[model samples]
Target: MKKDIDIPEVKNVHVAVVQEKHLEYKTIDWNAYIINNSDTDLETVLIVSQGKSETKITPPMRHTIAKLPARSYAKIEFLQEKVLELNNTFKVTFFEGNKMFDKTYVFRKNTINEKALQTLPLMQLRGVLVK
Candidate 1:
């Protein structure tokens, strides 16, 4: 039965889009990161992302991490300005001990911009946090 299965609730993990300057290229780039705020490490971490709109849907992008240490973060990918106009989604799953957890974070169209920048958790960077 579905109720017999244990699907743990996801917490202390987040997906964020950060705006960073490319000193070498004299340009800027928007990067996605996965943050782990829990005290335990996450193993076999997997993140699938995509951009979608009523008229168009970008191909799903898959990113994986063998293990994510506690209280740290990892960069997923870079986003172009054009992609910023589409609804971006990040589906994250990982295992802590013997339990599995998953969560989806979505950044609505036109919401990933400088005006929405804020200090991110466990990192000294300013970016938009998926709500």
Candidate 2:
């Protein structure tokens, strides 16, 4: 009975980081997002995130999206300059139809910078995407 449940593999879902400019503050900011590229809607979407390294760990932050329509995206959280120095991890879980899917996406330490900017799929904003 333990292995009878079917857990489908997550595909076309990703966590990405992007840079934003605050026109009023005249400063740049970094933010994280979840992208759903599949053709079906995802329900009960939940994302838990944290940052950690050899000697330090940050509190886990959680976010929930009631329903993420196909080929859409949602903002997860804003990334601080200090948090980017640690390895950031996002655990994503959601349901498609009657099946469940789960996946963990991570942004390695120091990897979410301007130099890593690229054309993001679906949402055309330039950012670092975790595939």
Candidate 3:
């Protein structure tokens, strides 16, 4: 007799905020990304703020990921007139194998590097989802 075995699904998706500096312009840029570590692709990806207050507090930001391939990443750029506090929260939702998953990531204000403002062409903030 032959038996069938069940395999577990891979759910190793992560979200991060990357800060890059431009020496020529003497400016710093911040970008958010959704990183997929699973073997399967994540479809119908949607990322947004968790609450109304969070949305109102932060400057205008855009989420630009329609689909995230396996072992790949998608970037989200923020369009702001002024640099606000780094503390923020986001909700990430995606589908994998007919199953949907959602997670929340928080970027603390403490992670912000005040010194990075004086420096140029440097990576300032890097955040990863905990657990």
- Tens-digit lDDT string for candidate 2 (2-118): 798777888999899999987888889998999989998999999999999999999999999999999999999988899999999999999999888999998999999989999
Give the per-residue Cα lDDT of candidate 2 at 11. 91
Model 2 alpha-carbon drift over 4 Å, by segment: none
Q: Is candidate 1 or candidate 2 better by TM-score?
A: 1
**What does each candidate score in C-alpha RMSD?**
0.9, 1.2, 7.8
Q: By TM-score, rank the candidates, best first.
A: 1, 2, 3
> Roughly what TM-score does model 2 have, to 2 decimal places?
0.94
- lDDT by residue (tens digit), candidate 3, 30-114: 5556678778788988778422234456544446466788878766654232333545667777778777777777665544344
Clashing pairs in 1: none
The candidate that achieves the highest TM-score relative to the unseen native structure: 1
lDDT of 1 by residue, 22-87 (tens): 899989999999999999999999999999999989999999999999999999999999999999
Ranking of predictions according to lDDT: 1, 2, 3
